[model samples]
Structure formats: structure tokens, C-alpha cells
Target: MCWKTLLCCSLWLLLLKSNENLAFKIPSIDFEMLHELGFEVSIPDEPGMQRVFYMLQIDDNCPALMDYITESNNGSWISRQKTSLQNNDKLQISVLVQYNDEIYEKSETRVIINARLLTTRDGRSQSITYPNGEGECHAYLSPQKQAKRCKPAQSIVSSSRQTCQGELLFEDNFSEAQLNRSTWKHDIRQRMYHVEEELVAFDDAPRNSYVKEGYLHIVPIVASEVVEGSFKLGDRCTAVESPEQECNIAQGSFYSIKPPVFSAQIHTRDSFSFKYGKIVVRAKLPKGDWLFPYVMLQPVSTYAETHYAKQLRVAYARGNSHLQSNQQEDISGSHLYGGMVVWPHGRAMQYLKDRLSKAHYGDSFHNYTMIWQRDKITLMVDEEIYGELYEGLSFFNEKCFIIFGVTVGGFLNFDDSVLAKDVKPYLNREPRAALSFWQQRDTWAPTWGKHSSMIIDYVRVYAE
Candidate 1:
């Protein structure tokens, strides 16, 4: 029994010593293999020692597109290597096993996979090929493991085409150094009749409107001097007020407040107009408190307004006085109330109020699309449809132009009363708290500098 035990111990030590000197053998690999193939190494399992680990490393010469995986259990280690070789490529694989803090490295194996191209119904294809006949010719094996010679086929064929949502009718990426005068007009005027008075005087100044680095930047700045002429107020106010108080009054073109803000308003009223199309404006909105950014569509004629007036008269005759008042207010032609609108049919307007929570408009650029077809008008933010209006509205059938601008301290700007009712929950319930926040800024410079910019990347019109 003593002799038998001695023999067993000697055999175990010999086995361990042999394993230490053992070299890793190269495994056969087929060039035509579609998925992962397992290359394994066998090691002798010893009784009592520390945990064992195995690792596989591919040399740097391997193709940048190839990937691999490795695993180990008991005394066996495996490396699964996969590649869709369209070109003839060579790879060097090496394996290592560690036990009792001692590592054993296998001899590196060189694998030569031949190139082949497979085309599918989709329009995507890849190619792989060896530069020259420098590498050995390995037999291509089928999925059934049958050895065969791979014949390089002719050029691959694919049948696929690109499609667009609509035909592009008008596109302005603002690539020029200046605003394209042929397609846009700088609307220089002050709006006087809205709920919250606009504090900025619109002007043709390049400082307020310019093109830079492929973007149209419409900025608002503190006015230096009062504008020197008298101009007519917006038509809505003119229609509502008495002749003495409304329409064509002689007032300074300048804003009412001292050192008032100045901004730009540009539109395609005369240069371009469309009846029905998909309008897309890629823009980054202004961020300041009380700032209003608008991208609007308005009628080019009074046809819709005339029709709405007749309808209102008919409604009033039927004793629908409440609707007459509401409709009058609704179709007031106030561009401030919506980003996109089929005016006179005010219900079709897209207010963009719900989108305030989805993302910070001032932080990034977003695509605002208004698709106006014969039967429907859909509004989308970043390809996500947020609002839609079906047909049957006579107002939307007429030609309409586009307008883009930024207004500050307008109706959207919360005063003490509005802030108290709406924003009080967000603030500390103080009515004047919101205004006080802006007052804390030095000379109100930060308000204009940090948060007052409306950047338009591009505007496109697509037709069916």
C-alpha cells in the first residue's frame, strides 16, 4: 500500500510538470463559417489550489471589424471567434490560463479567412478581400462541414431606392453671409394692441437680424434711440377702437419705454407664399422670462377674414352672441397666440403650450413642422405629432405666408397679477416675485445677454 501511494504521487507531479511545458495547438477554422466557432484548450485539473482563470487575446493585426468572446469551466477554456469576411483577412489568436497565481500561455495561432460577398434584398452590402496571394489557401467549408473551394462571384446586386416625405418646394438653410433679401422682408414696425404690449421696436438693423455659420440669428437688444416716425397700429386694434383712438394715429415709431428693446421680424409675405404644403422650421427658442418666440402662417388676403365676418353676422342673427364674442376674440389675427395658425379659423392654431415640458426649447435646436394638406394640418415637434386640424375650414384653403420672430415682455410675460395666479405655485406665491428676479440682474444686462436669442437653422417647404 505504501508503494502504491508513492507511485500515485509521482504520476501526479509528472502530469503537472508536463502541463507546464505543454504548448497551445492551433485549431482548424473554416473561412465560410457564418457564426461563432469554438476553439478550446484542455488542461489537467488538480485537487487543492486557488481559483483558476482563463483569458483569450487577439493580436493587433486582426481586422478592426471583427469581434470575439471567451469562457472557461473546470479544466477547459474556449474562445468563440466570428467574422463575416468579404475580404481575405488574417487573425492571430493567443490563449492564457492562470492557476495558483501561475500563468500558462499557449502558442499563438494564425487564422486565414477568405473573402466573400453576400447580397440581400436590402440595399446594404460589404466586401472583404486579400491584397495579394501572400496567405495560404484554406479550404472553404459549408455549414454541413463539407470542404469546398470558394469561387469569387461577380459584383453584388441590390434593389432598393430612397424615398422622401414630400417634394421640397422651398428650402433656406441660411448658408449665405447675409439674409436672402429675395425671399424675405424685414417687417419693421411696433405692435401696440396686444394683451401684453411688445416692448421692442422692430427694425431692419443687422445687429438684430443676421446670418452666421449657416444659422439665422434674430436677436433683441436695448434700443439706443427712439425711432423717429409715426405708423399705423395693427389692423385688429384699428377695427375695434374708435376712429379718434384707433387706426393711423400719429405716435412715435419708437417703443413706449425709455431705452426700450429692439428686435427683428422677417416674413415671406411678398417674396413667397403657399396655399398647402409641409412647413418645417428648425430653430432654437429664446430662454429669458417673458420671452415669446413665434413661427407663424398667416393669410395673404382678406378672403378668409371676409368669410368669417359673414359667418359671425349669421351667428349673431341666430342669437349666438356669446359665440360671436368668443369667435371675434379667437380670430383676432393675433400672431402672438400661436406658433402656427390657419387664421380666422382660430381653432386650427397650434399654441405649443404643451410642448414646454417635453424639452427646454432654448437649450437645443428642434424641428417644428406644420403639414397643411387639403384635408388636414398636422403640427410636429422633432417628428412627433403634437397637434392636428382636419379639413372643412374654408380659411386654410387660401394662400398663407410665413413669419418668424422673438418678442419680449409681451402678454406671455407674467406681470404681478398673472404671476400670482399662475406661477405662484412654482415661486413663493409672491405676485411681483417673477419681475423681481429680473430686477436683480445688473442693469438688466444678463436678461438680454443670457436668455434673449432665437436661432433658426433652416426653413423648408414641401409639397405633395
Candidate 2:
């Protein structure tokens, strides 16, 4: 009887010890210390990580587990190497969720690392709770004997681009002292029935498009300033297969004399086109009333009558410092806009607009960027991303070529309901749009000042 009683007591004590080890809460988890170390875990989302709160500092008796987790650099652990006072930062894994029940109920709120440091005779324990709470994971790394690895249903690679993933596909420093004609084709087409309804006609004149010092500048000149009366482009026009009407124009009635403005427009429609990648453009927006400066991507094979249709705008800004939306908020050179537009099967024009406001984008150069991926697209100005779109628009799924230009007096961007209508000369429906715009030049021209050029420093595209 005494022997049996002792056996029972020993088994009970062992069970108690086992429970204590399993109940171990996360250690070295002082948020104050984390702040002191300048180490951050997602109380909120960070770039590249959305709602993921993993960044844990823990001491491990198991060096094998620590090394595997830290070195893997994989999402299975969601970890990074960090430090503590004793420098006992063995493994980094974030466990405690902020515990928002409502958010957790809707989507995945947490991924637990159940590091069960249990005593095994072999010194390797099994634990590493996956997202779905399966029991297959073990503490030690096993090569052949492992969990099920699943492959995605669709291929992520794009068929149009043959470049290696993450490779630099295209880059231009604009330091050559001239536009690389092989890469950039000047667009000097006359605005007729099937072109942009802009008030300007692009031309290849040296003053309108040139490389000065090390920068590529696309400057806009008043047609009346370049020529006292009607201007003639003649054969210097770069647009191929242009019609005879493109040769000359004389100021006349409401069909609207020659284009009131002359600007430089350039694109890489033939030299380069890609399916999906990241694009970065360093540029300063032109500051001039009624002027439009844009960095965008155009469909290589398809064409849209509206310039903004079926295109992805990296950065677009109106030169007017006083323009406002129907809501009365300023929407001019002070604001940077980026978006993707699609005319969905003539159903309706569908677009997603993103805007960021500062004192003025023209005051200094800004980095405009677009990250185009298989599932998402992100637009950013400098360090701040102001726009994102998911797999909603099919227009973004195909290949596109890069385009940079400074255009003038397009009615779609400058809305009719703008509060600055007193200064705005032409509405979208005006029959003689160009005539009305030129007639009001007295009110808008002075605002152009000496800042009537769009300066580009560089453009780069990278494959994803």
C-alpha cells in the first residue's frame, strides 16, 4: 500500500511540472524595452506587411530552434534578429495579438508560434502551430520529412516580359545631353478628330523639347509667342503617317485657329514595353496655369481616344495653383494625383483616383513611383503611398509603354464645377474650346511666370 501511494504521488508531480512548462507565457516581452531598442512590432501595419504583428524577442534553451527560425527569414516564423540587455535575443517571433475580437472574427488576426519547450529524450520537441493550428511542425529543421507544401493555382510570371525577375529592365539618367532618340520618340501629331482634345499640339522644335545641361526639359511655349500669328509645324512633326492638315494652320473661326500652345511630348512605344514592374520617375511638376504635366504608361497595342483612358498615371498635376474640386478642396499644382483608368466595354468610365496635397509639388523635385504586381498596384510620392488598387481592372493586366509629356488645356482633368470658374476659360462642352482658352490667356498666362517647363531627372523600371 505504501509503494502504490508513492507511485501515485510521483505521477501527479510529473504532470504538474509538464503543465507548468506548457503554460509558459512569452518571455522578455516588455514593450517599453522594445521601444527603447527602437524595435517595433505591428501594433499597426508597416510597409510590405499588412496587419502582421510578428516581432518577438525570446531566450531559448533550444539553440537548434533559434538558429532555424532566425536564419529561415521565411514567413513561417515572421522573425528578425534583434537584441536585449544580456543580448539573450535567441529567437524572434511575435505571439500576443492586440486581441481585437471583431477584427479577428472577420479575417486572420494572428499566427501563433507554439514553441512547446517540452522535454524529449532526443532533445528535439515538436511544436510550431501553423495558421490553421495543425500539429505537423517540429522544433528541429527536417528536410525530407516535413509539412505539406502547396503551390498557387495561377502562375505569377508574365509572358510578355522575358527579363529575369527583380532585374533592372530599363533606366535613363537623362545625362546624355540629348533625348535618346532610340528610346524616346517625339510625338508631334496634330490634334484632330481621333487625338487628345488638348489645346496644345506637340512639336519637335528645340525650344519645346531639349536637353539642357544634364536634365531633359519639356517646355511649353505660347504659339502666339513662337509665331506672331498662326504657327506652321511643316515636316518637322515626328508623328508618323500624319495627315496634310497637320502641315499648316492659320488663325481663323471657332473650329479654333492653330493650337494655342506648343509643348513637347515623348514616349517609348516601340523601344520598350512591359507587362508588370516597378517604375520610378524623378521629376518636378511644371507650374503654369492650364498646363498639365504627367508621367504615365500607355497601352502598347490598344489605343484610347481619351489620353487618360486605359492608362496608369504615375504622377499628374495641374499647373493652376488656384483650381478646386466641387468639394472646394484645392486640386492644382499643390496636389499630386495618380490613378488607373479604364473605359469598361463602354459601360461607363471606371477609374480609381488618389491624391496627395503638399505646399506645392513644383517647389522641389519629387520621386513618383508605381509598383505594378500580379495582384495589386501601389502609387507613391516620395515615401508616402497615396493609392492602391487590387485585381479589379483588367486594363492593368496587359503590357504598356512609358510616356512623359507636358500638355495644356485638357477639359476632363479640370472639372467644369471647379470653384475657380471665373479664371477657367473653357468648359468641356465648349464648341470652340481652343479659341475660348486663347481668348482668356490674359488672365492665365502671367501665372506661368518663368516656371513653364517639366524637368525630368531620370526614369527607371524594374521587373517584379
Candidate 3:
């Protein structure tokens, strides 16, 4: 062959070699069959294929439940975690075929999982698709047994000292359209739960909390956004994760690994700090399963002040507790026991002594008052004493500020067994079931409605 012919022949051979190297077929994924069979599938073994895997993307509406799907092995796709899919949820499945550690071809499919099949009928049985594609199967879900409400115990009075009628040091009636930034610090941090063991996202946004109708309404609603990091600080404040640093007004920092349900938390840490006084909060608490209402005081030193003296923190919590036999006792429209905790010493002083009341505080407005003096700390509900500690007077000398908010599931009081049986099915894999279940309740609008709030009529501090 001539030089020109030889060059043309070489180019043709190179083209053939390139075509052979690029020769790969996209793997066909049976998504419809996979969805029907519960999203578990076995991929056919292909020669020269080094590895195979799948990626799942949930529809935008149900994006929070996207982490449920995972790859099990080189040839299978499996959902290792428990999840709930809502009606009309679209799941996008992408299958990647690789050879020599390089991606050869990718096949993708989107499928809708019917949610009606997951809803329980009479809170017991649910219809689900069988994995073998034989037919639908009915599974019985464990019933959520309601706990009996405790009978109202005899009211207990700790000290003969009458309710504090001292001169008012400060008060917030919440009469304005917006929160008073001068008096209250809106510590809008993302997923920072260091203060309490609860599932709640604290944000500065008005939707999570607001002042309206002459009431400071701190509402816990469904989360619209996900935030991850340490606490977000206010003006002239920096985030501190260690106790070595001296922060005059510090908010504890916590790392949240997953998306959380958003709520609101505000404090007087920077704005107001008092040594000893009478603090009274008149408010109506939120009612529903797994909700926690809190009015607390933390040392301005953020526990670091204990080096000078043991720092003190006092709080009032209600809704769920280990002292009570049934964690859901408060949500059954029955008795409400306001719990008091005084830490570094984790003590439930009220319930331990059986001095609680049976009043459903969620049904109406009630007063939660704390009297702190040099020698004693007392907690009362509606002017009736529930708990008191007389010996921890030295710690009470430290200046502490107030924090008001509500929270859901967390290490503090969440019971996973109860959750899986009673609330998990309805949660649909959403992380914050308390907020989700409360928003979906039929009585939410009629009974709670816009009033689904920790309505603070007034927060007053009285000094000697």
C-alpha cells in the first residue's frame, strides 16, 4: 500500500479499537417491579462489571425521608432503615454500572409508592405489598395503649411563706406586634439541643415564634427548613464549645447529625440576669403526644461559673417522665403533672414526693412560679407548691437568666418502644413525630388552632 493508503488504514483500525473500548450497554433496572416488591432488587451479574450500586432521591415534597434507602451489596438495592412513604411520593432510583472502577453506564427510573397501603385501619392492621410480588398482605400493628390518668393527689405546701408579692423588677405582656429585642434575646441557633434532651430546631424566624394578641406565643410547628451546626449567636456574642473560655452570656453548642424539626427558643441571658428573685410565668401549655413545655433558668456562666461555685439551673417540665407509668398520661385529656428539675443534681422533686396535681394544665392558662432565695428554691403551679429544695441555697447565689421554649423527642424523655408502637406508623419516617402528629390531629384546629402555643400572658420577676 502507498503511504496515504497506509495512513487511512491505520486511522480506520484506531476508530474500530475506540468503538470496541467504548462498547457498553446501560443496565436495565426493573424499577416498577422493585417498587412493588418493597424497593429490594437483585441485579444480574454482568461479565467485566467490577461493581454495581444505586442512588435514591425522594420527591421534593418528601425530601426529609430520603436517607432511608441504601445499597446492601454489589448486586442488590435495599432499604435498611424503617421509613414511611406518603401518598403520591415519587422515588427516583439510579443504577450505576461500573467496570474497572470506572462508571460505564447509568440507568434511572422514577416510581410512586402508594401511601394508603401504609395507613392503619382502626389503628391495628395495615396493608402492604409482599416482597415476592405474590399479593398484598395485611400486618397487625401493635396498639398504642393509653395510660390511665393519675388521680389528683392532696396539694402539698412546702413553706408557709405566701406567694411573693415583691415589687416588680421586670415584666413582658407581649402587647406589641414584634418581640422586644431589647429585653429578650432570640437565640436562633440551628439544631442546638445542648440545653435540653429534646428534638427541636431553634430558629430566630418569626414563623417559629411571635408576639401577637397581647401574648408571647412560642409555638412548635412542623419544621420547614433543616439547619446543621453549633448555636447561632446574637450580637456581640460568639459560639463557645468549651468551658475554658469565659463567655459572659454563652449559649451551649451541639452538633446535630440529621435534619431536625424546627421550633423556637428565646432567653434573657444577655438582656436580664438576676441573682435571687421570684419568677412567675403565666401561660397555657401545648397539648398533644410527646410535647415538652419548659420555663427554665440557666446560670449566665453556662455551667463554667461552677468553678467559682457550683452553678445552678432550675426548670419546670411537663408531658413525659419516667416517674409516671404511662408516658402519654398527660396527652389523654387527663391529669397533668408539672415536673420540676434542679440540676447538677438531676432530681424530680415533685413527682418523687407524690405532690403533683391532676389538673389538665393544657386545657387552660396556669401559672408556673419559682421562688429563689439565698437559702431555698421552691416551685409552684397555680400558687400550689409541688417541689422544694432547702439545702442547695449556696448555688442559688449565682445570677441566672430565663429561657422559654418547647421541645419534642430526645434523650431526656423519649421512649422509643412507645414511639414505635403508637406514633411511628403515623410519623411516616419523619424525625419529629410530636410536631407532625400534633399538626395532623383533627382537634388541632378546633381545640388548639392558632392557639397551639405556649402562650405567655406575662412573665414577671419580683424582687425584695
Candidate 4:
């Protein structure tokens, strides 16, 4: 019986000692360390900040509190890293507490100075609490720099007007002396193959097709020299190749390298391709008649026949147009072929020609844009929605990049008299009588030049 009583007494003593040694939790910030650390604080509603406040319970074995300051790289400001120190110079936080003939101690707040950039683990530029209940009250450094959604999207107005102001995945500035030597490639082959090359030649034509003020101007040269060369594999033009065939040509233009060959079709296919987003190009239109203005957006999928070009003819033939008659120049059904001739086959091309004939083109520099969502593809010229293809079109099943270029004449014929007169002297031609009748005629005046050039100002793309 006495042994049992002694055992219970010893157990009670051990419990008392255990309770005495155990430490308790403490608050984050202490009043005394604020001056040394040089911290500024403000409460949401209060005039000043709270220096000390009892939060939850504390831990026992933690050492005393110490505070230290770390300034920014430019020495603009100072913030606290550690706020507690004990006899051993060990860092910790201590909370004040009182009990009858006893006092408990534990590090209160774990101060962090010189924190990494705003991250999930580090709380942020403002106050944060750790999963373990330790915390630091950091003052709000700066208001977040918000980004404005593009017009018509109803997004917040952000300060970024320049192209560099958004989430940019890739950017290449072509400041190199020889732009062709940089991120560009050419397809010298004689067939229509989409070459996965980035470096594009806009007016790789003769001296008349030079890039000035960021726009590639395609003008005529009357020196019997054919303006036929283009970046990669493309046709050229010459005066002799004019449709009239009556004028002994001084110079003719052609993309003669090959039809459907990888001409100046620059793309980010193998290197990079985006999923869903918008691309905005601030540019002006290329002038001159017989000009073929085009932008190509092609989407590829691992599921489709990668090597073979999906016959858009078959796709569009599902409509009223038959495939055989569709191929002819004067056929009414030939309207869809305009979309098919470009390298990257898709609806973006189909809508562009219709958009160009609208009132907004040629007169001003406008934003030629493409908005690709999961369900729809929209083509816009100057903020006006020209065409929209629903998700039903198979070409838009995958994401794509932007490709743009201009040609003197390929499949479409603009035999307008004003255009012909403007073009006649450069390549000696028979002056036609009826300008309006020629303009209405449907004939493909293929530019027979070897090298030609197209121009652009700036290209920008954005993602969510």
C-alpha cells in the first residue's frame, strides 16, 4: 500500500516538472525590436499599427528574441529578417507572460529579412503566416501593377501600352546586321512544302522591294531585269510575264522557286507554337495593284497526317462547291480556292480576303489580329470582326502561329485599269480601254517574278 502511494506521488512530481519545462507560443512582433529593425507598419483601420498582441499559445523550447534589418539592393528601405536572440546569440522570439511565482518563455515571431521575391512559400510583400503557426507582419511594399485587358475584352486598364507589357513567352529583336542570317530559313525546293523556318524575307525582291521605315514597299523596276526572287522557295515576277502578253516586258516578277514550296513562309512550328490567345500586329497595308496580301495561320495535330497537307478542297467541298469545277480560274465556286492556295491552310485565310474588300483596309494603319480560343477562331482587321469560323472547322482544332506575306499576283487577279495603268510604264504594256470591266473579271495574274518583298511594322502576341 505504501509503495503504491509513493509511486503515485512520484508520478505527480514528474507531471509537474514536465508541465514547467514545456514552453508556450508567443505573438509575432515585439515592441522593443521595431526601432532597431526600422520597420513601418499600419493597421487597416487604426491610425498606427499594433506593436504587440497575444495571438495563440506558444512553444516552450524556443530561445529569446532577436531583430535584424536587411535593406534592398539600392539601399532604399530596410526590413527585418530575425527578431529574437537568446544568450547564445541564437535567434528566436520571446513572449511576455506571468504566473504565480513562475514565468514561461518561447520565441514569439519568426522574423524574415531579405526575403526572396514574392512567392507562395514566403507569404508576399505583405504579412504572412507559416503553416507551423509562426508568422511575420511585413508592411505592404507596393500596390500590384495591374494589367489591362485589350479593348472589347472588358479587362482592367493596365499601364502597359507597349508590346512588352504583357506575359511574353518569347521575343526576338532582329537588330542583327543581316536579318536573314538570324532566326530565318528558306526552302529552295520546287514544291509546296511548309518549311519550319522563322527568318522571313519581306521584299527579298530587287532594290525596288526594299524595307524602309519598317514597311516593305513593292514597286516596279523597268530595267528588263525580272523581280522574281523571294525568301525561301517562291515565284518571281517580270514585265514579260504580264497577262496582256502584248508588252515586251522590261521586268517581270515571279515566286518561281516553286508553287506551294516553302517560300517566305516564316513560322514557329517546330521551335514554338502557342495554345490559345490573341496576336496583334500594328501594320500598314502594301499598296499597288496585282498585290496579293495574305496572312496564314495553320494548326497541326499529332493525330492528323503530319506530312500530307490536309486538302482544304475536300473540306470546303462539303459545301455547294464541287471539287473538279472548284479548280478552274473563272468558276464561281473558285472563291474557296483563295483560302486553299496559301501554305498554312485554315479559315483565317478564308476570312482575310473578305475582310480586305471591306471599308477598313488600305486607307489606314490598322491592327490585323487573330483571336484563338478553344472553341472559335476570329480574324479581325482594324478591330472589326471580319469572319468567325466555329469549332466545327477541323483546321482550327490545334493552336497555331502567325504568318503574313504579300505577292504581286498568285491565284487572284486584280486587273483593274487604274492598277494596270499604274503598272503599265514599269513593264511596258498595252493600255486597256475598260478599267471597270477588267477590274470585275476573274483571272489569276500570277506574278512571274523570282524575288519579291512584303513589309510589316510590328507583331505582338498575348496569352492568358
Q: What TM-score, over all chains together, does every model reach?
A: 0.46, 0.63, 0.47, 0.38
Error of 3 at 93 (Å): 84
Off by over 4 Å in 4: 1-166, 171-181, 187-265, 300-360, 412-453
* Model 1, span 1-464: residue lDDT tens: 22123224542243243344334322322123331122332344443222222222222322222111223354433323332222233333333334444444333333433212322222211122234544312321112232221223321111112212233457899999999999887765554333234445566778889999999998887544433454344533213233333233354422222224567777776766666656777877776544566576666663221212111000000001111122232211111112232334433232232232323456677777666666655656665665555633454445676777776554323233333343311232333332332344343444446546789898887552
Compared with the true structure, the alpha-carbon lDDT of candidate 4 equals 0.31
Q: What lDDT is reached at residue 452 by model 1?
A: 66
lDDT of 3 by residue, 1-464 (tens): 22223224532332222223456765444432321113443355566665444434444221121121122355543332122222354544444445444454343434443322221112211211123534322211112221121222211112223332233456888988889988787644433223233555556678778888898888777544333332333442332453222122123322233224556777877677776666788888766545566576666767211222133333333443222334434333234433233455553222221234455456678877776766656666665666666764654446677778876545334444434354421333344443344345443323434545677898877652
Q: How are the candidates ranked when ordered by TM-score, highest leading? A: 2, 3, 1, 4
lDDT of 2: 0.58
Candidate with better lDDT, 1 vs 2: 2
- Winning candidate number (lDDT): 2
lDDT of 1 at 368: 70
Greater lDDT among 2 and 3 belongs to: 2
Backbone N/Cα/C clashes per model: 5, 0, 0, 64
Off by over 4 Å in 3: 1-165, 192-197, 224-239, 242-258, 303-359, 415-451
Which window of ten consecutive residues has the lowest lDDT sum in model 2?
Answer: 100-109
Q: Write one digit per residue (lDDT tens) for candidate 2, span 191-292.
A: 532223677888778999888777889998886642246556666755444345564566554464767788878888778888777788988889988889
Q: Model 3, poorest ten-residue lDDT window?
A: 120-129
Candidates ranked by lDDT, best first?
2, 3, 1, 4
> Which scores greater on lDDT, model 3 or model 4?
3
lDDT of 4 by residue, 292-324 (tens): 444444453431112333212111101111112
Candidate 4 lDDT at 101 equals: 22
Q: State model 1's lDDT.
A: 0.44
Task: Give per-residue lDDT, candidate 4, residue 381.
Answer: 56
